[model samples]
Target: MSEANAPRVRVLVADDHPVYREGVSRAIKARPEFELIAEAEDGRRALELVQELNPDVAVLDVQMPGLQGNDVLHAIKRDGLPTRVVLLSAHLDSETVYRAVASGAGAYLSKESSRERICDAIAAVARGEVVLSAEVQAGLASEIQIRERDQRPALTPREHEILVLTANGHSAPDIGKQLHLSQSTVKTHLKSLYEKLAVNDRAAAVAEAMRRGLLE
Candidate 1:
């Protein structure tokens, strides 16, 4: 199809800051390939408009009142909405980038990114491509490496201690005595460890932890 006849990609912009939202909205409006459908000042309203208008792409601020950008992204995924999402954040930490990428965001960009870059990301996302800025891409790579090196499930410090004691063949009550914790509390930690390790008993938990290098 000719460029003039091509359908514009519908877009929604949501940010708590009116100036930033307007700036982004204007950029979208100026793009010949994109159509600015709506603007929301908060996440809840963003989600509501998304459901109502079914835009092809949504540009969301990571931090917003009423519902976080991540929450809205999850809701869209849960409801199986066809709208692709582009997340914008002033904070671009590795953990944040990892979480956003893992949760199905089509793109993650710092708010400091150029308007042209944001517009390009929305266009790419609408075409079913994942877009990441250079900084975001580096952060995501670092986060993935950290995750890989620590393959163990999320265990609390107390749980790690319990696992160590259990590996030494200490019973739950014995562990409680050594740690000066109540027997019930020790058992609770043990139960949580088992659940996290996906094991049914202390021995299995210890073995799983060892295999996962949590004990090393």
Candidate 2:
């Protein structure tokens, strides 16, 4: 097909840093396959443009002012928008990777990535593929190892059962009734499990349990 006939991938760039945003804008403008639809210096504006423009893909800085990239991604998902997202970050930390993957972001890349890689990521995400940099993979690997190493073996069978029930959305009284234990007993078990998992609440305990592979 002719270049003019080719479908252009509509893109929105959002970042708090002007230099990086301009660099990305220039890169997008240089590519014929990509059409820069809009740019925003904060997450709130980014979200507004996304809702208004409905671009094919959104390239977002992870640490933007107002709302963060992950927050925008979550909002997009909650609103059931069709725009795919690619998150850019200065570092590929485990929490960021976790949120990106969990929130259905199409790509996670470093701000230091080359222009070619950035363009490739935008195209990849526009094509509905998940793109992860080597740095993100390494961070994920390290996160897995840390979770494995910190796996809590001190949780008793009852505690594990309680956690699994809690993860399944059971209330403490419901779990107690199902397990033939008193509500106080269930709460006590939950407290002990939270201590072992280094969490403060049932929700955190459940999330930590799932992360550590203690609850499948």
Candidate 3:
């Protein structure tokens, strides 16, 4: 099919590694339906190219000099660029996966993914689909579960001690005396606990803590 008549997907490839960028460029070139429009050696250049070329999809490295992949993604969104981003990273930690997805990245790919998988991700994003590698999916799932499990108000050790003392019928002054803190400081901790526990007073704070098993 002639280039003019063919349906082509324009792509921008960005990475700090010369070898890796070249490999990805070659992969994009190998597919007739895809066109390699631009390449960047850093996140800053990647954003520049995105503004200039406005490629349908951008393949960005998660770690790059000048700006990281997530930063680039935010820039694209801020500028209202009609580009879908596929983030590539060597690390697939839960936080990384969660952040990428949360930042509106179209896909998350590990550096160890096969060339075919990378190509598939690009195609998927071009088709307006959100793609997550198996590892990324697992990491995101685990992160979500952990966040849900730890949704309760977080209390510091000192706060826990204070709360326990308060539950045992100790006033702020008494608790402060036992913990070697000033009454004002004890009141400050109580205020913080009230906000965290979403309660108004001492009784409500203690009740919420007990309900969440935070006191135990």
Candidate 4:
């Protein structure tokens, strides 16, 4: 295959973490079939880059101080950019995961597994497939079953704990350490929780949980 014709998966990396954002940029640049077209440190900037670059894919972090990845996802869809968005985030709970997916992200990929996983996910989303951690997919399934059983959530013990942490703005790794589970496990539970709650993202989850009096 000739170099120029190699699918040329140009990308935008959006994250506040210099290390992660740089790493993602480098990872794509190092590969033959991929290109790092631009980088953004926050949602506002990400939007600008998307408009200016119109990359094939956007690899974004879920939480930015402002204008989060979800907002970017909406913008990409709203403005009809040819770009597809893949969320490369630290694990959010099942609830957050469900919301991320529901928000129309092309793919949801965890930062913990992103070294190789991000590339794989971007490639898949470039091909028009939704993607997430394997654990996330299973957790969504289980959460659905539970919601059906009760017509509401009967959060597993771990989910109950995660719900509280999520409310407090604790990152997935923090919740995982507190709960003695891996970060991915915490994210899985959160993804399921978000689905059961019928919410689409963290702010909504926190607001809904607060309204329901589920956390302090």
lDDT of 2 by residue, 14-101 (tens): 9999999999999999999999999999999999999999999999999999999999999999999999999999978886797688
What TM-score quantifies how close candidate 1 is to the native fold? 0.72
Q: Provide the global lDDT of candidate 4 against the true structure.
A: 0.82
Where in model 1 is the C-alpha error above 4 Å? 152-216
Clash pairs (backbone) in predicted model 4: 93-190, 93-191, 94-189, 94-190, 94-191, 94-192, 95-190, 95-191, 95-194, 99-200
lDDT, each prediction: 0.93, 0.91, 0.92, 0.82
lDDT of 1: 0.93
TM-score of every candidate: 0.72, 0.69, 0.71, 0.64
Residue-wise C-alpha lDDT for candidate 1, range 1-216, written one tens digit per residue: 998999999999999999999999998889999899899999999999999999999999999999989999999999999999999999999998898899999999999999999999998999899999898888899999899777769888999998999999999889999999999999999889888888998778888988888998
Give the per-residue lDDT digits (tens) of candidate 4, residues 1-216.
Answer: 775776788888999999888888888887777888888899999989899988999988989967988888888888878899898777656777776787778888778875677888888899899887876787767666655455545777777788888888898888888879998888788888889788988788878777755664
Better of 1 and 4 by TM-score: 1
TM-score leader: 1
Clashing pairs in 2: none
Higher-scoring candidate on lDDT, 1 or 2 = 1
Report RMSD for candidate 2.
8.0
TM for candidate 4 is 0.64
